[model samples]
Target: MANRFLSDLDPTTAWAKAAVDGKLFTCGELVRHAAECHLRDIRHGERRDRATPQRTSDNMQWIVNAVRSRTNCAGKILIEGASFSSSRNWVSNGQAAAFDRLYGPAGNIAFSPHSYYDADASGTDASCVAGAQNRLDPPLSWAAVGDREIFIGEQAGSGLDAVCQFVLPAAYAKLRDHPNCIGWTRWGGARRRGSTYAYRLDPSNYQTGEDTPQMKLLLRFLAQNP
Candidate 1:
């Protein structure tokens, strides 16, 4: 609708006018506009990752700094993708150290590392071997700097075995004491179905199943500790 309405006018002028008018816009529209504009610019420019190098770098840095600023100011921050350093380098250099140094008063920060515990357990290597042991600990890792609480946002949640269940109690017990280190939260909260290696509430129907019982259990554990 917005695109069609602006079709009769200059696209650039229309966008600027809409911004100046303070027109109500949804987040989805903003993302759509950004993606379309970026894609178009890419198509028109040199076909390279560094196409529009300065503008692209500045935009990305602006986003990263804004998020980092917010995280530094907040009491709790949830992080992911640090473990898989291979895919898309999520954490920036010195960012972790900045978080650690800045939040040194009450230890109010948490770092959640991602892992597939079951897969690691089945592995025969040394590194994978240790991960198999850490699986004995809660999959989530929370780090407190000063009074700040930091927690990992996701954890392995597939192929349940006795060892996997065993790690929860001690991890939650420690988290309970911090008064800020809340219990580990499930990534998807068991929403998917037929996710044999993924986290889901109902693995039975693989479509519609009540994972309420499992969620209720998690809630109870958090309430007792938090």
Candidate 2:
């Protein structure tokens, strides 16, 4: 992350510690400034530590603005917000708020909520999303921000066919045809596993250097929907 994006968080560069020790900003600074202190590099899976889950989600807002100004490809970008631990139900609230903040500031960006496996039987589906929304349903910022901007990114297990037939369709129906939904993006474009991850939709299995049931399914859905 540091070699490329300069976002890596080192212990010495703690943004949160700086804020507390430097004594520069007040509680009002809590929401906007202070990079190392906010733990922008700290992800959702780390929420188990009890430091504070939603903190990075709120802090990422500034990072969003920075990305737009510096990166040329930020235009019409699909930004996946900080996500909760896909393996557990522990951090859904933090994920929800992060999703909102990531896409709230500019029309150039769209929300891509990462959907990895959870025990709930509804991972990436409407029901799962609803569960995540418990802390902030429909995101209080959605209406004023924009509609047709929500996209669901999925990480289906090796059962790509099942996800295509069941998860994708169910999720699409649940989203209620938002018109702007980007549908799904398979993690690692389907190659994350030596085949270990729960959603082992490893591209090597179905992608014969070209074809993938997942992509085909998503394309078909988009064709039909569009």
Candidate 3:
């Protein structure tokens, strides 16, 4: 879930109401339901509004409390400290403190950030900018300050020759060198035959199971890093 807005999770909101009607959650029961279901990790919010830091922090605290209160659930929670587009201002703007108050001492919580190498870092474009790997520097500095662990929840470039040969290797190297960054998951793995996503990892045919260029690159990186 992108979970882009506070209203996205607000039960009173029309969309959220529709979600509830579909049995997504009862009011005040989103976290509880996840806990009861024993999810391994719950990313409560992602790239929330930078203007509403307090409400975002409060929402996260609510999730932390819900998880902590449940002895039967051992799942961890993941947080994104800044906007999906950039983490550049997060630490300096006191956003880290708001989250630290709730998440700092909790061992079961970690920072999860989505990263992309495209010009806008939106993962919508197949073309990548030169030296896009440097985008991780800001988030890396933020994680270092709190001695926090990081999991790159989403990352990918297209299967284009230039992207696979240059963009991905540098990005993978950056993540590998950063000890705080635990690992990363590649985006766009749809198995549908007609899917048009740029970064898909699935093979063209299920039976043949031929690896895409992106998957082959990923496999090579995994072997080298592992």
Measured by TM-score, how close is model 2 to the native structure? Answer: 0.47
User: Per-residue alpha-carbon lDDT of model 2 for 1-226, expressed as tens digits?
Assistant: 3322234344434445555455556533433345444354443234554224355454456556655554554466554443332313223446554454445345666555554432353343222232332222243235225553655544442235443455544554555444555455555433433444434343445556543454566557668777
Once fitted onto the true fold, the runs of candidate 1 whose alpha carbons sit more than 4 angstroms away are: 1-81, 84-95, 101-116, 119-142, 188-198, 206-226
Local distance difference test, per candidate? 0.39, 0.44, 0.65
Model 2 lDDT, residue 221, Cα: 62
Candidate ordering by TM-score (highest first): 3, 2, 1
Per-residue lDDT of model 1, residues 1-226, tens digit only: 2333235244554554454445555444444444454444434543453234334433334434444554555444343322231111113322233234332233333444443334433221112122343442232222332343434344433324344444443444544555545555554434323344234444345467544433444556668766
What is the TM-score (0 to 1) of candidate 1? 0.42
Top-lDDT structure, candidate number: 3
Off by over 4 Å in 2: 1-53, 70-74, 77-79, 83-106, 117-148, 157-165, 173-176, 188-192, 195-226
lDDT of 1: 0.39
State candidate 3's TM-score.
Answer: 0.73
CA error at residue 193 for candidate 2, angstroms: 1.7
Winner of 2 and 3 under lDDT: 3
lDDT of 2: 0.44
In model 1, the worst 10-residue window by lDDT is 81-90
Which one is best on TM-score? Answer: 3
Q: What is the lDDT of candidate 3?
A: 0.65
At residue 44, candidate 3 shows an lDDT of: 42
- On the 0 to 100 scale, the lDDT of residue 148 in model 1 is 37
